[model samples]
Every structure is written in C-alpha cells, then in structure tokens.
Target: MSPASDPNARSLVQAGFSSDPPVSNPVALRAYRLARLRAELRARDYAGLLVTDPINIRYATGTSNMQVWALHNAVRYAFVPTEGPVVLFDFHGGLHLSAGIETVAEVRPALSWFYFIAGAQAPERAALWAREIADLLRAEGGGNRRLAVDKCEPLGVDALRREGVEIRDGQEVCERARAIKSPDEVIAMRRSVAVAEEGMAKMQAVLTPGMTENELWSHLHQVNIARGGEWIETRLLASGRRSNPWFQECSDKPIAAGELVSFDTDLIGPDGLCADISRSFLCGQVTATVEQKRLYGLAREQIEANIALLRPGLRFAELAERSWRLPETCRPNRYSVIAHGVGLCDEYPHCGYVEDNDRGGGYDGVFSAGMTICMESYIGEEGGDEGVKLEEQLLITETGVERLSRFPYEEVLMPSRWL
Candidate 1:
C-alpha cells in the first residue's frame, strides 16, 4: 500500500487545517511538468538537455533511483531531446529494476564509474558515456551541435566536446522551467505542507524543558518520512543561545524553559518538492521576557511585510528596494534576502537586500503568476544573545498571493503592545 493509504505508516494524523485548497490530480501534474520543461528547451534553442543533477533528472524524467547516491557521485544521467522521449542512463541497471512511471522512452545502463573492482580507467568510462550520448544526439536529429548540460565532471565534459558537442548551461533551463508552478505542482507542495505542519503540531504537543534538540528534531523527521516524504535538506533546529546567530542546526543541547527554539524545515516531501518553513517556538509554558517578545515581533513584522509585497508583475529589484528596512540596532544581523522562489527546492530568482542592489549587483526577475516563494527573516541583535527566525511559503496567484504554510506562530512570543 502507498504511504498515504497505509494505516500503520503514519503514527499520528492531526486535522485542524481547513483553509488549504484542494490538490490537483497527480497524473495531470506529471504531464504538466514535462510540457513545461520541453517548452523551456525549445525556447532556449537547445538540441537536447543532458541532466546529471539528481533533482533536474527527476524533474525531467520523474525517476528517483539512487537519487541520494547521485548527489555525491555522478552515477546516473537523463537525456531529453527537444521533441523526443526522455532517455535515462541508469546506474547498475536501476532502470531495469524500477517501474516506469514517468515519460521515459528508453533506459540504458550507465557506464559505471566504480573502477576499483576491475582497475578500469576513468578516461575509458568517460569516453564510453560520451559515445552513447553522441549517438543519442545524432539519432535525435541534433542539428545545432549544442547540447545543454546541467552537471558533469570535467572528463565527461571534455569527452562530450571531443564528440563534437558544445555543452551549454542546462541548469538555467531546468530552473526557469521550474520557477512557475502549475496547479498540480501547487497541490503537491500543499500536500507536503500538510504533512510538515502535522509534524510541527506533534512537536508542539511534546515540547518541554530538558528535551534535547535532537529529540525534538526527530519528531519532524519521523512524521515526514512516515507520510511518504523523503529526507530533510538541513538540520536547522536549535534552542536558546544556539538560536541567536541562526543556522546552528539541531544539536544535543537541552531545551530550557522560557528559552526560544527556532527551526527551518527544508524537507523534500512526497513528490520531491520541498516544504520550506521556519518557526520560532517558546520552550515549555513560560512567559517570554520583554526582550524576547521584541525580537520575535520584529522578525514577524519583517516576514509579513515582505510577503505583503508579493504580487504578479512585481520586479525582484523593486521588491528588494521596497523590502522591510531593519532598524539600525538590528541591521548588522539581518538576513541577506527578504524572500526567494521555491519549487523543487529553493529554485531561483532570489530577491536580495536593498543594500545588495545598491552595490550594483542583484538578481532581477519579474514576478509571474504560479510562482511559489518563501519569505524569510532573521532578527538578532549583534553581540546580544538569542534571536527569532520566521519564514512562510506563498503561492502567487493571478490576483494575489496565497499563504501555503499553515504552521501557527507562538502566541506567547508576541509583544504585549502588538497583542
């Protein structure tokens, strides 16, 4: 049984979120993804795209065999011609053993890079892989002799070049295609968010003084994987002093009552999309101090202010120009970007700080409908201890933006004046 259908797979399921919209059909979702990618390749005038980045390969072909292993080693690859079926180069006959769920036309055994067993040379392996790719390009009617490649080792690139193939930047091709979410992509993200928030709820219920940061983080990982989600991207969970500078990740430090805990969930969920959300939690059932409330309020304000600025037709530069200005006391410790695009995993169009733009170099892209973005904020006083981090995922619609994240804020952390 699928994880969603298995009764024993999920240890707990909570049901308080009613505001989330219905998800689109998964079958249609996969189709939409392929169409978008093809459009991107055609627009860029590429003969074909060679995707070696595991995530890009998954995006193009919808297969996840040895994806984790591929992250560190270039074992598998996928080839998508401008107008033909996707050809996946599976390592160690994984394609033969796996089910063909996506739009794959062919699966060929990849040239193994593991040379230890037979004392195989690296040059020979590279040449063999390049010859196979060249054959595919010729068969696919590659006229321009230019093939876009996302990731490849130097030897492999050299081999391709020797085969009369000019390698172009294929990472941009995938990133541009994935920047805008189709209705079905949005639904997948919502499902991911639903599971992530449920994990958050579980953590909230059991949070108390003396709980180790590792113990608290386990709740999130357990629930995520239990609900068909894949591994998390980062270990960004910390408490008290560790939360101040940010990016501390989960540690063995014990939680203290009245101390603040912050976490960011970069979880790759059910459909390979990420549910990136951060929340600052107040440990135990103690009233937050005045300083703590002030910091949380400031971070919350920054998050909300940037999210409000999200809309179709807005340019990244303008958004950065109009981003929330940190007070002089907190400017030094402010996060670099107010927000960034999110799809498969922090995709593209990073909206950076106004200061960055003022220095004459920053990303610039017009906001379009169907783009999902994450608004981020980290407010910590320099030289002072403790900080509050907040982030929310949003879906850009034709008219406005929808908050995709459903995690609740720590009410006790709110400043009395704001309350």
Candidate 2:
C-alpha cells in the first residue's frame, strides 16, 4: 500500500481528517475573560483600564494581527463601571474603516461626537491622548478611580505619568484570568495537538540514515504547514553527539548508523492554541553505550507515572518532585520537569519546577477542568551516546486527565533497508 493508504503511516494524512471544522466565535469566551479583569479592577477601585499587550488585547477584544502600538491615534478600549459598551479611541484612519471586519471591540474613533483632540505632531499627539485618558477618568470620578495599565513600555509609562495619569500594573490580574482554559480553548488546543501528532508521524516514516539533520527539519516544517498550522513555533532537530539540551537547530551532520536523533517541534493553530512535543529515534540498528530497549522502557514508565499523578488539587511543586524521582526509580538522567501548561504561549504557567516565579509559582491554585497541559519525559545516560525523549499533550478534567495525542511512544529504529 502507498504511505497514504498504509494504516501505519506516520504522517498526519493517515491519522485522520486534514481539514478542521469552523470554530465558534471566541467573542463569548473573551467576554468572560474581560469580566474577570473588570472584577479585579473594581476590587482595586480602578476607574478604567488601558490594555496594551498584543496578547492581552487579543484576549480582551478578539482582535489579532493589528497595530497594537497605536495608543495615541486609537483608543483600543476603555472600561467604565457597570456600563457595558467600552469607550474606544482609534487614531488610525484605516482602523476606523476596517473596524467592522477586524475586531469585535466597541470602537470609538478620535473623531467621534465625544470630546476629542489631535496634536499637530507625533509627540504632541501622544501627549494629547494621555491627557484625554486622564480627563475621561476625571469625568468619571477620577479622584476615586484607579487606572490599570498593561504593557506600559517604560517610555510610554513615562509619558502617561507626565500627563498626570495614575497607573498601576495589571500583569497579575491578566495572567490570573488567562491561566485557566475554557472548554472552547481546550477544543482548539486538542486540534493543535492533533496537527502536531500528524506532523510527527509523517516525519517518522521518511526519517532515515544518511539524511542530514537540516533535511529532516525541513520535512517536519512542511508537514506542519500542510496540516493548517499557522506557524512552526519551534523546530529543533539534533542528532548523534549534539542531542543535548543546549544543542538546537539542525546542522549538516549526517546521522550515523547507530546514532540517536531527537527532535522538538511546536505547532500553533489559527486560534493561537499551541502544542509542544519532543521525540527521539534510532537510525539503522541498536548499539552499545545506549540500550534502546532499556531507555525506551524507562521513558515510557516515567511518562505513565507522571500522567497518573495529574489530578485536581495537586500542587505543581509536588508534580516536580514526582518527575525528578521517576528518574531515580526507572533510569537515571531523566529531565527535571516533564510537563507544563500550554496555551497562548509554550511555557505559560511553567509547571514542574520549584521556582517561585512565573506561572508555576502559586501552587495554591487548584487544577481545574478546562486546563490543557503537556506531559514530557526523557531518559539519557552521561556519555550522551544515545537517549529517548517522549512527550504528549493532556487535558485536565473534573475527575482526571485525558491524553490528546495517542501516537506510539515506543522507540523507533528505522532499518537501513527501508532507508
């Protein structure tokens, strides 16, 4: 049978449908996120909020791939107490015209019936916007209104301060709302993982001895794109002696008969959900130094153990501890943390570490039903002659976790005859 018709074909084409059905409008989901932000602002006694981060902006208004830096010319969004329609200020002429097509925001152009002014120059323009923002807050009881600002690049914050606007950081509030995933978000994430698994399976079939690392890298990239991936977030292919953590990207190095080839690829769907997976393969035949059977068994056992421990109310610190202990029990030299939360970013809510900062810092938060996480674990010896890395994405549920990618995790050693 042709590879496409072969039941065991590794490429995504054989896995299932290549096309995805249309997803519902992310507007309702975004509104829920905004509600969380509003509650935070109200608790802090803030009058209005000025959101500037692109990701945060997208999270709030469902607007993606637009000029997020046009603060002075456009009023992206301003939220007032209790009232629903947010005040929008857009300085970009094109934004006003394309508002209907691009974003889901209640847009307010600078030329609207509301009080407005445009400066003669760029610096003056920014100053004017800052002044208008302060004035809006003042009109809405600015004395008691605390203003929350997101992505206040130092220079912009300085300008706002000069305009006499009181600004407080909103990073924590935003991250809190984004940390938990919704049902829709989980659906999108599952699709992203499916696309990634498809790409991996395809790469596995064609990977062979004598193929340069760069060639294999290209094949992975092509498969990901063909599967509707918006971008290949990351592509790392290392072979032979270069399969260490520090080693990244594909070089001209040829795959030796018995060497191991390890790859890490990240795929992102149009909805902005991401899936990250890493796998290792043996070319030709098994050799000394690295026992393929032993390492693969260790990796599988470690991954299974880690998955079994995933549940609601489990502390991230506890997860890290369990991950480290697996290496000692199964085989030595396993990774520190085998998994983490996946969403808009690859490392969001960085789990499995003892660090007190980043997303994993607060172990107090319980694992809820909608969160999608990636579970990864690898086994390698000191000599670095060979190793095995296996990874998969999972969805945390009310009761337990469900594996999103079911691809085989066993060690694969393509024979020379096939190559």
Candidate 3:
C-alpha cells in the first residue's frame, strides 16, 4: 500500500498536512514565473536567456524531467527571449513533457555535445548546437546579440562566441527574478513544506537505538518519492560525535540512547520547492542530557534571534552585524551563513556573518517582501561531543516574517518552544 493509504503512515502524518492535496493553480503559477524571468531579462537589456540549469528551466517553462540526472548532465534546456516566446530543447524523446505548459511556445530535441555524447566529434556537435541558438537569437532579437547564459561548457561558450553571440552571466537574471515570489509560488512552497514536515515526523517516529544513520535517512527519501516529491539534496543526518564537526554526511554508526541526532532537510518536495528545515532530536526514549539541552538551546536561540531580524529593506551587512553572536566556543564551527534564500532549491541572497566579511565571504543585498528565506543555526564547540542544528523556513512579508516551516523542535532539547 502507498504511504498515504497505509495505516501506520496515516498515524504518523502531521495534523495539518495532506499527503496529496488538490493541485494548485498551475496556470497562474506558470504565468507569474515566466513573467518574472522575462522582466529580469528586460531589466538587464539582454536579448534572451539560455536556461540550462534544470531548476531555471522549471522556473521558466514549468517542465520537469529527470531533474536529478539533468543536474550533472546538461541534457535539456530552455530559451526565453526577453519579450518573446519560450523554446524548450528537451532530452531525447521528451517532447511530450512540456506539451501542456502554456508558457513553452515550442519544444525541440536537445543537441548535446558533451564528451559522453559526442566523443571525438564534440567540437562539431557543439558548433551545431551553437548554430541553432544563434539563429533563434538573431530571429527574435532584432540585431541584439547579447545573450545571458546560466551555465555552459567552455567549448559551448567558444562555439557560441564564434557565432557572434555575446554571452553574459544569466544566473544573476534568474536569481533576481526568482527572489521575489508571486502569490501562486508561495502557495506551491507551502505544499512543499508540509510534505517535508510529514517526512520528518516519519523519521522521528521510527527513530530508535541500533538503527543505522543511513536507515534513518532513508525514511525521508522514501516518503518524498512516495508522495510525488523529488530528491534530498544532502545526507546530513548524524548522531553523537559525528554531529559536532558538521557537514558530515550520514554513515553506518548505530545511534545510542539519549545521544543527540541532528539532521538538515535539504529535502526538495512537491512543486520542486525545498523545505530546508533542520532540528536536533534526542534518540530513543530517554530523558535528554543537560549537555544536549544546552547545545540545542543555543542553536534554537541563534535561529530565533536571526529570524526576528528578517524584514523588508534590511541590508545584508546590517543583518550580519545584528545577528546573534555565537559564543567563542561555538564560533569556530558556526554555519557558513546565517541564512539563505530558498525556493526550487537553496537559492541566492545568502546572509553571511560578520567574520565572513573580513575574508571576502560576504556581499551586500537587501531583503524584499515575497522572498522566502531559511534561517540557519549550528552550535557546537570545537571539541564538543555532539552538535545541534536548527533552522526554520520563513517568508518575508510586507510587515515582517512568517514561519513557513512548522516542524516542532524537540521538547526535551528545547528549554522552551518559541511561539
């Protein structure tokens, strides 16, 4: 039986979420996203954008096919002319994928010149690929040769340049366009968050002593795929000592009772939105350790303090200055960024810490309403036994911020839950 239909799965389901909710208004969502990308292109005076990144393609054309495979192999792409139609060059035999997407004006078989596909004739194949793109730009651009490209191989860039097509960074255009989400996009994100939380609950329910870290992490992937969600971006669940020096992917070590278990759900859920929530839970049925509570409490404090700073028009630097200061013991292993934007995946406008600025790890930007940000915190002293990670997905609004992720923290670990 499907997880949604299974009795045990039903019992673990969160109170407010639906396993398969009614489909959202795709028409409005697609229209809003396409318009946003076009506006960004127009603002930069680019003739068009060559969207090879699968995430950007989904944003522009609303066509998702083999997204995980396409991430490493650029087998499909889309082109959005600044003021014209969107043309999708899909993977082999994938024409039907975008048939119902109103924003996609045309679909064609993609030409891949990557080494694996073209072998010794890669150069020749790249030229052929460049020729088609140049012709499309000339026909739609009205003498404008400036084209923004999100990503491409050096051979492809050279080939396009040979065709007199000027290439600029299209990632900026895509990122800026994707920053301020439309109403329908927010609706889609809400669904993604709910699905992720449900998976989290399942993981917690089955979590027990002697369960390998991999076994616990697999529940998340199983729930996601079973519920029509996509992939988990990272294997970040760790128990006990492994949790201290963060960024360690899960392993085979058996979790012990009362030990701290930390996980980051870089989980891509429904509609390709990420429910990037993190939490540390006490393993097995035992009263939490004082040390565990201390670490978890600090992480929660950091997340809450940072999340409270989110508001429209707040500068990135000012946020770094005002963000909660990690104590000296925990400072060395702090999370790389205080927060980051989240949508189809972990996105742009990363909020960096003050220390990052000294080493050129920071940039200046301003928060805007309609942008969804993930507040992140990781607190573990350099030589500590276990670490705690806590994050919240939030939506920046006209007035302040709204917490998009509703997964509750560990009552044993948290001194007091934040309302």
Give Cα-based local distance difference scores for all models: 0.82, 0.62, 0.88
Per lDDT, what order, best first?
3, 1, 2
Candidate 2's C-alpha runs over 4 A off are: 1-8, 11-22, 43-45, 66-98, 101-103, 106-129, 132-144, 284-290, 324-338, 354-364, 411-419
The all-Cα superposition gives candidate 1 an RMSD in Å to the true structure of: 3.8
Scored against the true structure, residue 115 in model 1 reaches a CA lDDT of 49
Clashes (N, CA, C under 3 Å) per candidate: 0, 10, 0
Q: Rank the candidates by TM-score, best first.
A: 3, 1, 2
lDDT tens readout by residue for model 3, 278-373: 988888889987888788888888888888888999999989999999999999998899989999999988878899888866788999999999
Give the clashing pairs for model 3.
none
TM-score between model 2 and native:
0.77
Name the 10 consecutive residues with the lowest summed lDDT in model 1: 10-19
Candidate 2 colliding pairs: 10-201, 10-202, 11-201, 11-202, 73-91, 74-89, 74-90, 74-91, 75-89, 75-90
For model 3 the local lDDT of residue 361 reads 61
TM for every model, in the order presented, reads 0.92, 0.77, 0.96
Off by over 4 Å in 3: 1-22, 416-419
Best by lDDT: 3
